[model samples]
Target: MKKINQLYTGFALAMMLLMSSCVKDLDQQPYVQETSASVYAKAENYKRVMAKVYASLAVGGQEKGDGNADLSGRAANAYLRIYFNLQELPTDEAVYTWGGGDALNPLQFITWNTTDEWSAAMYYRILYTVGLCNEFLRNATDEKISKFTPAEVAEIQAQRNDVRFIRAVAWSHALDLFGIPPFVTETDPVGAFFPRQIKRPDLFSYVESELKEVAAALPSRTQAEAGRASKGAAFALLAKLYLNAEVYTGTGKYSECVAAANEVIAQGYTLEDTYSKLFNADNDKRTNEIIFAIQQDGMNTTSWGGTTYLVCGPIVGSMNATERGVQSGWSSIRTTPQFVSLFTDVTGTTDRRARFHTDGQSLDINDVTLQTDGYGLTKFTNKTDAGGNGSNYAEGLVDTDFPMLRLADVYLMYAEAVLRGGTGGTATEALGYVNQIRTRAYAGSNAGNISQGDLNLNFILAERGRELFWECTRRTDLIRFGRFTGNTYLWQWKGGVKAGTTVNPRYNVFPIPAADRAANPNLEQNKDY
Candidate 1:
């Protein structure tokens, strides 16, 4: 099994800290010197470089608590839960007041206020990661290390394709978050800069083309490189891109999503049969369901601070041996009643929907006991006590591997894409995929009945919420449907008190962090900042 500590080490921490520091310095660093003659001098050396590129995949800027305390918190207050609040702001779901520190907090009701620092940080992290991949590709040559024979050269090229695939992931992140980003190629000069935003459709086309090229070149499997990106991972990401193509480019790529998903499904991947097994740390690297996860190790040379559970873990009604003993000042995230209502009792006994309550008890909708007006999301529940060190108070250090893609995700993407493409697939046909996951949750057999015509975009969106709760895809899904700006329950409630009931378009994009604006004068702020 791959050790997470060895993969992330102090490097992840250094990268996170440095990303927040300075962007100009990134331009000043020299690329690793390489010549056509000396590149790829050793097969093992090239392998190590490839490994480093894989390692960079785990680096992320959003703190765990940032989502729970702010994004999820804001969303819960809006009467939507599971997906991030990015969707709630525009929908009738949420509203915000202009608090001082982050104007985007309040202005989320009115406009996109993303700052340059936020954009720059995301760009910096991705570019830095892409830089590592490019460095390996640059230095990988047949002559230098002389350690590789002809066969090894073929293998190295395949590894190089994996690096390219990772770079594509970074690019996708940029596109999804920023809409249009500058596409700097490997051949671009190290410090040369470009300041134009490409159109979203144009960027999506580029990403699609790149994934196809790399996926065709990637190996089907590699035992020695188990945690690295595989052909399946490439296909999964391609499927996701295609699934969202209509949203990103205003063009439906549902057929492409099906094709890409089918490719991964053909590779013998399947959903794990148990819901809890999917989250068990010990089963992480072993689960076939996980196509690509940010490999994490709680014990080892490259230790990551546990973040997900720490941030999203339930607050104690009262502290106990099993509960993290922190005072419950910020029980930030809660499930929406809408989401909780979706869970039906398999036994057909008394409805246990009240299990979702913050008070840890069920209540009938009409019962006065439902006064907390909160839904407890058990999906990220962490029962561990805060370690004696008190580090658990901060988020982003969770030991759980943040799953980026999984086999079940691919299956559902295919099912949804096929249904939306006007292809004749039954809810029964789709149920085959959905039931595999539902059965694992022991949530009873699939409803086993849905019609293609019945499979409206909203149905698929809700299905995604049911299956991928708290997986960080909520923001994208909401935006794609134009619901991010709608006034959902949370927005209606909060807006009623704060802004006296108004809708805002700027909430679609986050405000650029203020710190970034001070750093780059050329960086224009997202409108309403």
Candidate 2:
């Protein structure tokens, strides 16, 4: 029997939802022959539209197998796929070796320009998500609520906060990736379809405010419904934002970060004892650790992005794809030796979290085009704990939900914030939190525990990479620690050199995509391209 996760169950009927691509098109007409009045008139369809908002973050489009994408022409427009590229590729954590057609090398090599495809697609994708969320918020008016039953009204009311939370999530990504990005809300003036750009600090405050509001409104719990954003999710996002506050706003908000982490840790989520089980096909059942996730059902909600990319990207033909529960392997993603060096033992015996696949793969990435030059990753898989493939494994689609926010990340944030001079937490507590994660990694033992002297900023940074590898937090983490675009740190191909060299500091925040700039006069590129 499969677990019933209803997060995206209503997405098929959400076709009536309208969306925008960028500043020039705030109200693009629906693809279907449906007017807003005719579509949003009913109360039942509200939930379906909300489902569309959630699906916007996970799937590429409305069509099956990610065909006929929501934003067409570019297959890399999927949120997780592009987000993974921007977050992981430029840093020392991971690399993509595909050539000829896809626009991925610039990401890994740190040479992306204003017209780069991945950044452009990501810009529109985030805005598209905001567009969907705005549409949902636009229709969830009090006037519309009065037309529905009280029970239905209650549900719609709750979703309004969730929608805001989701929108805040998109905006937060903008704040983190692109220092200053165009800002839009449901309350924009009727004619002001062109959104005004917000400063990085202001956008940070806005995101913080949205998270705080939702944190108060939504329930703090052990887990949210498969794809729903909850109070814990809000707190988790808050902690993440505050942890990197100095990078986004030039202000160290470690105390605030600790407070937010405290709230999330209080939500009663325990570590899933078996680390691998937390990311398998049946991860939906591991709600104890995953605070908020984007649901993916193999049979109903099939996608080429999301965990399908994670489970298949690194598994080449030489690797046993069937054992990993997918039909084929892409061999597209691999890690540099710097990342593999974080673990004393790449094998899982000493550290169960060290799940890198090294067979038929070189430990060093001497060439950017050879996938086998870097170590393959196995952090995510399409196999269920019972040793079975996902529901649609034969088709290469998967059921592994993307864990956007989890308890372990919160723990690391809490520990980091404390070590960074946060006031609310003690050193002992920080050490305890790190050891809690270490205990899990060391397979329920204390051998991997760190002493007080070993628990420093350097150790926290490495510990974060070790624990949260392939989780899409690397670039931001490096930027915060001053290691992203300078000579302080080097990986196999950092800044496009085999030995690695310093990159221009302007590369810290990606320039606004030239396509978006050309389309909208209101938008400006980041400080430099």
Candidate 3:
């Protein structure tokens, strides 16, 4: 099921969407469109509407390339693109060099305030998706189900469960990135008073329960469709929620994290032989390893955000644009010197994962604002495994799918959980798993294998960096390890200082956007914003 093909076609019908009120933090008006009523009359139309729910993540709006957007500024309003910037730019994993004075550039230097447009865009994107899910759930109530045939009702029940999984994912991100989000649901009446904010612990419980219930209802890994939620995706998300349970809920749930990861590991998802192929144009077919992804296509689902940013953001200054499979480089996003050093082998001869373009670029970033200061990453491209420009890709656009969850991260999560004394895994078992990951990184070199004595928390952190940098896991991983903020960790230009300085712990979680707080007084800002 390539959900995008069926999903994106329903955009014209998406005109029936209810406008959310500014004061209500996503206020809903009763969906009263006659077209929507007629469309929902058929069972198959339900599936197409469900595609719109998933489409919100891949494309900004109903139409391609920015017209008729669900949110304002469809060009920069994409979920994955905004998500990547928020997650990776503030950390050592990546930095941008274009227009250092751009309002969004403050994120790279950790100087952003609550008024930042970029931060506001990220908050709105998450809530907008949540609102879409809420509408779908509202339509699937018992009242509506009573109108359908028994068979259609059953199908509705299953899709409704999948929608819950989707909702859980969005809410989990809210809980993870922001301390808490303004909460709403199908039960909330349209045009009701402003929705109150839910604290982190309560949000955690809600997300956890929803995932468990939906995981049971979803299709098994092998039977699941291409872009649909499966038991594997649910389990993977549960594992992530549990892994960061201490941070979100103030209680360590490493044991539960291990349990959830073990479920995904047992699902028979094997990784591809080459690491780079996982990010190339043909990645949609690599469903064996990718648990869930924001599917992007050069021709079918065109967008300047999402994987298009990934393909074009890093190529700058003498890096071949044609070789990168893009029309030209944006010359903006690149990795920090600290991140490049994680590979250890400057030549990239040891680890195939070190896909850096060192040509005419320096290893040290003396000036974070200069394009030539840091190494350009070539990890993501619109090329295929055979090194040909992907036949499916177009100039200035790409077919690379943005992988949101994959099997390799699950392996590392299991190891980290066990090291933290989580149940269900032994130190020896964790060592073997880490070694298995390294063997591939080193192309089966015996020297790359670690001994039992070498396995520890610090080693796991470095290994995760080596395997998962630029994948949007760096900031959360750093936070979980007590290195994201404060004096515990520092990188180039941290806290807007050249030598790097400690920032207030409040920087750990982004403040609820000022515009949202002003519009909805029921919402309280994160402390010290």
Best prediction by lDDT: 2
Candidate 3 or 2, higher TM-score: 2
Clashing pairs in 3: none
Off by over 4 Å in 1: 1-45, 59-112, 116-120, 141-155, 221-224, 301-331, 344-357, 360-373, 381-398, 422-428, 443-455, 488-503, 510-529
lDDT head-to-head 2 vs 3, winner? 2
Clashes of 3: 0
Candidate ordering by lDDT (highest first):
2, 3, 1
Query: Between prediction 1 and prediction 2, which has the larger lDDT?
Result: 2
| Model 3 lDDT on a 0 to 1 scale | 0.82
TM-score, prediction 2:
0.95
Please identify model 2 stretches exceeding 4 Å from their true place: 1-5, 16-32, 190-192, 222-224
- Cα TM-score per model: 0.71, 0.95, 0.94
Residue 344's lDDT within candidate 3 is: 77
Task: Tell me the tens digit of each residue's lDDT in model 1 across 1-529.
Answer: 3453444443433333323333346566654434423434546456555655665544332222222121121221211121133433333222222223333334333433443222334445565666777667666644433466878888777777877888888778767766655556666665656544466788788889989998887767443265667788889999999888887788888877877887888778866755544553444544478887766443321222122432334332322313332323233333334455455642223321123334543322222112233344444322232233122333223344556789878767877787786243445656577556555554444444354465656677766766776666766776666655555423323332332254464555554456544554555555654
Per-residue lDDT tens digits for candidate 2, residues 23-88, read 346577554456566667787788788888888887887777665588865533578888888899
Give me the displacement of residue 373 in model 2, in angstroms: 0.6
Q: What lDDT score is found at residue 242 in candidate 1? A: 88
Residue 96 Cα positional deviation in candidate 1, in Å, after optimal superposition = 12
Q: By TM-score, rank the candidates, best first.
A: 2, 3, 1
lDDT of each: 0.53, 0.84, 0.82
Residue pairs with backbone atoms closer than 3 Å in model 2 (clashes): none
